[model samples]
Target: MDFNRKEMDLLAIKIRKNILRTIASKGTGHVGGSLSIADTLAVLYGCVMNVDPADPGKKDRDLLVISKGHSGPAMYAALAARGYFDEGILDTLNKNNTILPSHTDRLKTPGVDMTTGSLGQGASLAAGAAFADQLNGSSNYTYLILGDGELEEGQVWEAALFTAHRRLTNLITFVDANGKQLDGPTDQVCSLGSIEKKFEAFGFHVISVENGNDTRQIYDAVMEARAEKELPSVIVLHTVKGAGVRKYAEMENCHSTTVNREELEAFYQELDAQADDGGKGTGKEA
Candidate 1:
């Protein structure tokens, strides 16, 4: 399951393209958050996670609970790409009868480990799951990804305390510190000053990766977190809202949008160009 930079880059490109296609089919969805987590999800699903598409509910399988559940499009894309379901299902996202809603639902989705969308509850659930695994003497690890905005909820801190107090070393949390929330920038909305320091104060080990789009750094950070036996780990990842697509990445209103046919065509064209750009399409812009 080891992934080189090239393979990781390709996975990111595929995930980004899948997201764009899904949004196009849905006509409206959460593009910004989904794109922001593409690289991190790529490294996890494409390489690190010990998940089996055939036995998604296996007792010893690694778990990935997307705390920022609005980013379900990305998770769905990654899971489908990883063979948990038919990739064609992505086009049905957000439809009335589609299992792929804007938020994840474990009951309906094959690869989803938790049904999360109520803000801060997902992190708490992830912690509980991790603690359960530890108590049962299972070697499985649980990974949680939280939005910076979601951290404003009081329950996130409560979960942090619980995870640290229990010393759930099998759990790893990643804060998508993309700065922007739904309405505005996180700093302006409610300053979560020094996120890493706050985690350290909660009796957990914390690491800050300046570039969230760097697959290698994310991989190393997660590996380091896994090696820690005494405490839970949090990695504060700096990211852009709409990451890979250039125009969307710069646009303020890219969080959720109506995807017209023309825009969808253009976006897919851009993604194809990115995939064909040799080493330049690796999600890093100069």
Candidate 2:
């Protein structure tokens, strides 16, 4: 289903709402990181990715890996919104025997392409998947999303080097430069200086999208990346930790939180307002 700009915006808002609701239902989850990547996830599933909800295991289909798998709620919300499974399953997140764990699991989830929870491994897995597809002479692309904090992992840089060395044009990476992590601001924690330049130094074609929360911009960047034939592309997206809902976005400790019924209702209402206002849900409120 091809979504126009407005449709994509609404879908992203709905996905953000779903993420909030799911976390709220569970009483606790990664709200900040998950909410921050809602727009990017929305664009991928709603516009950029060539995925079939009914045939998720199609060999030639595009793959997406969430490297910072703590943000699994965002991916689950996106998959559910895309009709990969019944949306009702969202309420069972983090529950016993539930498929929706804190991280993605390909073995348990219909739309998940890889099992990812260990921060840096998912990037390597994504690069490997892209290389395998290349070996099989398939044109499908592999998309991987990583948290800015995840860059602290040496394995992520190793995978980046491997991807660039192989010239895996079928692979695209996005860094959710949300500035904050489980502890505090990434710069304050570990100081990953010049993310785009780091990827460029690793021989990747890098693009920095200031408004990563804009679905149109995200779609355009993905299209541009897909057109590149010589290098793996990296999009350094500047984002906020808790993006959509005003309360969480402003909170310093929004990374993970216990939500009450009132908080959940407010979050949904804010999402609805943002959708109605045609706001992209990334900008700071006045």
Candidate 3:
């Protein structure tokens, strides 16, 4: 499938804007991690995934499993932009009895294929889903997104081994290696030595993108991962935790914090400038 770089870039910026708006509605949220994966989510929902907003559970459509469930705002933005639901619902995020929760839930959201929040369980669930699809002779792909810190879980390794053993080439996983977690920098918390090598050792066809905030790079990586037919694939995305917003991107504790609505207009102005410049500022590029 071919992608229009300009369109992808615009979509990514819009997703980032929506993320901030959604989190701001709740006063505070997982903004850092959510912003980190905006570009990849744009690539997937824009042209890669075979999902229908009108028919979300179509049998042949590609499925996405977000292991790092805290990043639901990004996914929700993509979904709303893709017409899965009205964008107005984003204001209900994390509110009582709201469909758009802080974490992804398949039952609560139209585009969410798997409900996840316990860190490593989404990996196992994605693996099992892929294995099931393999058994049923389905041509659909199961895409999984994991936070870099999530790799610290022993269960992630177990899921990796299972996917490798099963040879589930239809499954493609992405690691949002934004360098920070809920606590602090991933290295300071628990160094993950060479994420690429670790996945490679787990028998995955690993691909790394230096600038994960770039939509073009992320799209290319997905295409490359799709070409691998022998083993499961993982794309390690080296992204900025709060990309597209200079203020948050540079913060040491942007993981979960109150988004000052008074500052959103200024932030949006910056995003507009970046978009006009083809997403150059804020380290985001098409």
Candidate 4:
């Protein structure tokens, strides 16, 4: 797959649109965090990961585990963009018998590799998969994405230690440091001091992406992290809660909010206008 930055940008835009669609379908969902990770997910399912929508169960395929599984709408949007499933299914997000659940469930979704939503346990589960793959002599890499708020869980550090002790080089973790969580800002809730230093202390080669919302930077970060041989790698992405959209990003509680039908229609119009202006319809102004 020849990765073009412009195409990735378009995909990220589409994924963000899908996030809004999912939110509207359910009347409410994790809009902020979902939008925050759109660019990163676009890079992964679009170009970075070695995955096949056709052979989703292939043995050597790379795996993605969204640790902050509440952002499943973003992942679903990416998967749909990558041809994992029909894009039409995106509207069923969180609905009855909907495959697109609020959180990631591997068993229900076609391309989801891990069922997550228990906050901090996803990293450990991903590490365990990496360890088992190493034992089996498989070279597939397991990627895990977590929200900054999730760092408050003790299990994350425990998993980090385990990954380091075992030297799980095939495991790469990305922390979406969006700064805000469900309740409030991370600082007002529980300030995770020096996230990079803490991960480094846990034996991860920490790489910081100043702009986590940039597809090019996220792609580069993943490529750079893939080269680490001695220990696990973690990329901390400094991102806005509602990244692409200016209105949501500016909102204090965009973490999870309601978007009525009228607001949703306005958003699509906003996206189209941005696209016409040669920008990714992020609802942001210059």
Candidate 5:
């Protein structure tokens, strides 16, 4: 399918808006990470991935496993925008009996392929899925998204080793290197010292996007990853925590915070400004 850069960029803005709306319904959420990955999700769900919203369980359809399950709000927004479910259900986020939980759950969410929350576990699960697909001679790809802090998990490296050893080219992984995690800056907590080099050392093709919050860059990187025929690929996204919202991006702790309707409106204002400027609406001022 041909990718429309403009359409994906607009979709990213819409996804960010809905993400804030979803989290605001719950009063608090992992807004930082959720906001950061909006562009990538937009590029993937907008046109890249081969998915059927009407048939969520379609056989051999491309699957996305968000290892940083806390960012489920963004995924939910993307899914809703892609027509997996009614956008009205986004207001039910984290509520009692709501399908949109705080984390991604395969059984609960229509488009979520794997239930992920326990940090590094998603790496193994996605790798296993790719391995199975490879064995079955399936061309469908399995995409994985992991938080930068989650990379500290030993199991992530273990899964990386396995993926590289097995030459799981069908597996494409992304690290949301937003530089901030739960407590504070990821580097301050535990420096990952060059995520690209680490992935290269692990025998995986690594692509680093300087402005990962740009849908165009994310889409280009994904295209590059898809063209690699030998080794597994990982794209390290250099993003700002709480991207696309100046107020939240400036906050000392946007990882998880309270967001009222007023604050949500302020975020929308910033996005609106970006939209008016004919940009991707990530609120990264030039």
Candidate 6:
């Protein structure tokens, strides 16, 4: 339950690196969005979220539901880093008959609480889990992450409204507002005007983090959300579509980029150089 911001930053870097390597192993995956939420995932699974890797099924433990499940590579790296499963499993991502798949599958992945891939269903599922926990008098929170573009789905709003109406304070959602989406920038694709105002209008206690890639900022936002008592809280994370790695971040459209052998080698080489440069930064890519 205790976290050092510096340590969390390093963990996020490691997770992001693993995500790149994993997706590279398969020659393709959701590289952009996966990188976008790396810091947030590290803050959750590494800094916060009370759950035992050894006792993943324990009733009183906190749960995480990834609504934008295409970003599973990030979550998978986080889970493996936290010892939910062997780290080697990450290299097998999306391989035929492998536990790791294109999208998150609870039945398949060791630490995945809910299977999600249809874009907007995970929010509703997390809401249902939160409501059930509340009814059962459990002191656990159900955390959900959704992409900014995913918010275009009407189902997410319905779940948000329900969470607010029921006063499901135990449910906290993080919108990964990384600007761009599959087609292009979310504005050009399907403009979601003022994500913060929209969540606030849905009766959520909203907090806006200027830099979602900052572990300290992410952790602070979660703590603030945890302190809210009246309604569900939503933290709007302003992030780069492809975070951590500079080349990917600079891409205009990196929803899912193909990584050939040379690209992957160059990517890891940059990370190696950063490490050689002391890897001293706390936030943002080195």
- Backbone clash total for model 6 is 0
RMSD of each: 1.9, 1.7, 1.4, 2.1, 1.5, 2.4
Tens-place lDDT per residue, model 2, 1-286, is: 5558888888988898889878877889898889889999989988888899999998678999999998999999999998999999999999999999999999988999899999999999999999998999998889999999999999999999899999999999999998888889887999999999899999999989887777777888888898888899999988877887777778987888876767777677777777756564434221
Task: Put down candidate 1 lDDT per residue, 187-274, tens digits, no spaces.
Answer: 8889999998999999989989988877888899998998998889999998888888876687886778756657766776676676
The ten-residue window of minimal lDDT in model 1 covers: 277-286
**lDDT of candidate 3 over 67-94, digit per residue (tens):** 9999999999999988999999998999
Q: Model 1 residue 168 lDDT?
A: 93
Off by over 4 Å in 1: 273-286
lDDT of 5 by residue, 1-286 (tens): 6788778767888998999999999899989999889988998998889899999999969999999999999999999999999999999999999999999999999999999999999999999999999999999999999999999999999999999999999999999998888989988999999999999999999999998887778888999999999899999999888888877777888999877977877877777667555444444422
State the weakest 10-residue window (summed lDDT) of model 3: 277-286
- Cα lDDT computed for each candidate against the true fold: 0.87, 0.87, 0.90, 0.87, 0.90, 0.86
For model 2, the stretches where C-alpha displacement exceeds 4 angstroms are: 1-3, 280-286
- The list of candidate 5 runs beyond 4 A from truth reads 276-286
Model 5: what TM-score? Answer: 0.96
lDDT of 4 by residue, 121-240 (tens): 899899999999999989899999989999999999999999999999999999999899989999999999989999999888999998888877888888889888887899999988
Evaluate residue 246 in candidate 6 and report its C-alpha lDDT on the 0 to 100 scale: 76
The TM-score that candidate 4 achieves is 0.94
- Where does model 6 exceed 4 Å of error? 261-266, 272-286
- Judged by whole-model lDDT over C-alpha atoms, candidate 3 comes out at 0.90
lDDT of 1: 0.87
* Candidate 6, run of 10 with poorest lDDT: 277-286
lDDT of 6 at 144: 96
- lDDT preference between candidates 1 and 3, better one: 3
